[model samples]
Target: MKAHPFLLHKWQHWLALGFGSGLAPKAPGTFGTLAALPLVWLLALISPLWAGVAIVAAALLGVYLCEVVSRDIGAEDHGAIVFDEIVGFAITLWAVPFNLQNVLLAFVLFRLLDILKPWPIRWFDRNLHGGLGVMMDDIVAGVLACLLLHSVWLPLQL
Candidate 1:
């Protein structure tokens, strides 16, 4: 079925928005993540540890929100509802420096892992259902990205 106009449909509207990032195309997930920059910045300002904690919290929260939005839209894991991407990307950036290069790297890495959906991610996507399933896989990817970033950083530190 065709998606209704954003204004008339509450869930559809929010879904289109990524709850807000759904507005961008060509790379809605990337844009959805970029849309989370401000929150990422604010969290970074507080502390990396805090940002990490927040990422976990956001992922958990996203599961519920995504589920609700999906049901409203008569879909499952609609591309428009990209809050999962936002939370995942935020998790990726956690503990990383706020530099353009790092941001780009994290973005690429997060998207790769998210899209590739290696082992556990693929497992979750196929086996689990509903919002929790949708968000859980991305959260796992985010954690993987976090580990990769640390590994990349460790060598550079020397």
Candidate 2:
């Protein structure tokens, strides 16, 4: 469906679209994930506790933002609505030490889990609907990615 003319003008759409990264002609989800890196870095700079708080807040707000934009554009889980990606990426980086290697690993793993939607991730994506549906699959992906990084990858590095 064609995007609403006011999609960009609305605050919810602006955020739900990942600050316009979701508008990319192709690979909008990838672009939205990329857009989240800077936010992850900033959150890391603040402190893991604060970063956690912000990630939780963003995920909560994302439901409303995603829902409003989806309704406005007359699409469910539109590729252009990517607040889920942003929050998911943030969750993947939670408490992760801010380093290029760690960040890149998290990025690759999160992207893979998100795109692949294995098992319960796919289950959530398929069964849920509306805003919660839009946010959950990615949330699960982020959690899995974070667990992998913390449990397997980080241990191997030690």
Candidate 1, overall lDDT?
A: 0.76
Which parts of model 1 are misplaced by more than 4 Å? 5-16
What is the lDDT of every predicted structure here? 0.76, 0.89
Candidate 1 weakest ten by summed lDDT: 3-12
TM-score for each prediction? Answer: 0.86, 0.93
Q: Model 2: which ten-residue window has the lowest total lDDT?
A: 1-10
Query: What is residue 44's positional error in candidate 1, in angstroms?
Result: 1.3
Q: How many steric overlaps are in each model, in order?
A: 5, 0
Sum up the clashes in candidate 1. 5
Give the per-residue lDDT of model 2 (tens digit) for 1-158: 65444367789989998998998889989999999988998998887888888988998999888788778878899987888999999999898888888889999999999999999899999999989999999999999999988985567667
Question: For residue 88, what is the lDDT in candidate 2?
Answer: 91
Candidate 1 at 72: error in angstroms? 0.9
Shift in Å, residue 121, candidate 1: 1.4
